[model samples]
Target: MSTSEPVPDPSAVAAHSAPDAPRAHAGSAATPALRVRTLRLEDEIDLPAHLPRDLTAAWLRHGQGMVGIGTAWTCTTSGPDRFEDASARFRELAAAARIDDEVGTRGSGLIAFGSFSYSASSPRPSTLLVPRAILGVLDNDPFLTLVDVLDEQEDAPDAAGAAPTDWRDLFPSTPRAERTRVQIDPDHTPDEYQELVRRALGMIEEGRAQKIVLSESSTVHLEQAQPVATLLSRLAESYPTTWVYHLSDVIGATPEMLADTEHGRLFSRVLAGSRPVAEGSELAEQDRRAFRSDAKELAEHAFAIDSVTSRLADLTTEITASAEPFVLRLPGLEHLASDVAGELREGVTSLDVAGRLHPSAAVSGTPREAADAAIAELEVRDRGGYASPVGWMDAEGDGQWAIALRMAHLETPTRVRVQSGGGLVAGSDPVLEHAEALAKSRPVLRAIGRPED
Candidate 1:
């Protein structure tokens, strides 16, 4: 349970870095690489199957891996132009390099990992990072990229000589997974969050808003800092059905697919209107019927669907959405989830799609401007990276972005903050909404080593 490894000094690693032979690379942010070489291999290896689950600036969803352990280059930025700004930086790096890929897949080349704030105005950090090295498994082909940075070497070397022989050589054999547990402490008690929920409902009654997403955050104090790989492994095991992610300091397993684009095909998953699933409870017949027939749940889900399709209307074609939502069950909760997919019209990028669809009614609320106003007035602390778009982007502008839900921020060496929220519509009950927030939060608590009912 102890996170006591003596991490190597980064400067020592960078001193030996260089690009491969026959390639020269120069980026404004990174020292010029004499050459960049990538060792790649192909197999039928299931995406994440049997891979050493190490802590990297990475993500694993639906079996694909996006690893960012040793980054040679990184971009940390803020403001409304954050996404485009990061993309521009990647462009600068790409313009000056030659990449050697033994096997070419979507994730075979230049890679970046991102974690953005819920709002542009949020004071929290927003980042886009690129590893100096990558151990990626895309479509079952594994690759390791190494950059050799030589200030002044009389002899340039072959890519193979400059890089580790095996990807396994990149990371040390780590400790087996842990059983670290934490003491749970919340920013607001259940009753206090319920009061905030009631206040939001009152704002709706006053005709100030149609819906509000009220959330609660908890700071968990561990006996020691939880090991990153151990925590990530537990999350992946606990929520295999979701996208388990860790980028910089933000981490979680989120079920909501904000946007995904591949070869001009796009898909987004909308989740709203939730119900808790106890650890070992098979719903009786009546409980299932009410979830399907409840007017409040139905309305909340409808708003989510409409929010997605409407924003995507002008950007896509052959659009299709599920006529009705199906129940999506996770470890401790269930939600009304709908899938919306379409083909990109012509020049639409995944980032554009994510930007437009972000703060969807599912997370922010209806009539976004008003809902944001309510949250700004009600939420006492910044949301950091929770409930925002978090994922990766490639040189081709094709990628996957998911709503950063069920997330926690590793605040410091000994502290982490888990966050969760609920959508409130007319006829909403504060007590019920508070319970929903707790259910949303429980996943992170459990993942961080709290094994409890």
Candidate 2:
């Protein structure tokens, strides 16, 4: 998909009228009306397995036009000491952009962007991008009309006449295995962990917040430095369903929401109690079936669904939630999942639901505020962009927000930083907890050219 020239700004063009604006119809329903139009892609395509190359090609061809791309993968961890707070500063930049004001008050239909993740310790981060401006840009471009065109080349024969292997090789080389090493938090005494959890629980009792996410860090000392891109690609390959993404200083590698509209076209999948659903050839039938039947794991997911559904109900009208958890299989792993839908009530917006449901039990823990504080004290490193909400929403309240996981931020190509951790509860074991963290980092390590073993 390519375009010839720079796409004109939608704002400069005749305003198409914001999605939230009331239409002036002579004979509409008497009740206060809400109108929503779906932005369905005329075509959908899966890019050739050679993602980076294809991405580069697409960029060269259509970089002039406003384009939207979604990259999903598992990423590598750059070790615990590599984490930073660049996301806090990114938030400041967004605030400076006045994105909230631009989209909320001014009704400019501005873009919304951010990151989401599962912990401060994920090796793999997922990301998604939906540029609202692309709608206007592609309005006149024939090459960009279908989503399928992007997928069209997936099965096409390679020019060299060799059968395509797994698509993972499309990217550059990842870091060597020798560089992967685990580190322990110097300050993480057992007493300290207990204290942190106690204080977090107290905060919940005090009503500062319901649940808070807490993290404990284990540092991994690398034998040598690795490239950030290599780690990102590994993560993408490992977890195809997860929205693997990397910003210069931010990462969003989890599956949350992407481009959800009132009219009910949601680009992303919500993982709750059942396994994530798999599409595409990357996942095998046996793997899919096993993922679908994992009940013990599903129980773990129910808390997440209950939390999200309850929060949505408090904020919206006409809410509907899935009764059973479904499978959501990404490239590297699978998740139990569900869906919640509802009409936005009066005086409510997407961000409203987001705020209410953030630090979800899936990422944080039950009794939110307490879990968060526990994570802060127990986890040696600050989360920065890890487990935060990241994505874009437009002025029309049509946008996506995904949990950032399976991701890393490039502090420098040779010195990228990443983090990954898991949810802990009363039954949690410290050793198993540590292993889970390591498993999560596999994606990032693979992205950066590190071996899983």
> Number of clashing residue pairs in every model?
14, 102
Top lDDT: which candidate number?
Answer: 1
Which 10 successive residues of model 2 have the least lDDT summed? 1-10
Q: Tell me the tens digit of each residue's lDDT in model 1 across 215-309.
A: 78888877655666556666777787898887766888999999889889998999998888786564566887789788999998988898899
TM-score of each: 0.86, 0.53
lDDT of each: 0.71, 0.41
Cα lDDT of model 1 overall? 0.71
Off by over 4 Å in 2: 1-110, 116-238, 262-299, 346-348, 451-453
Candidate 2's displacement at residue 348, Å, is 4.3
Model 1 ranges with Cα > 4 A deviation: 1-38, 42-54, 147-162, 172-174, 451-453
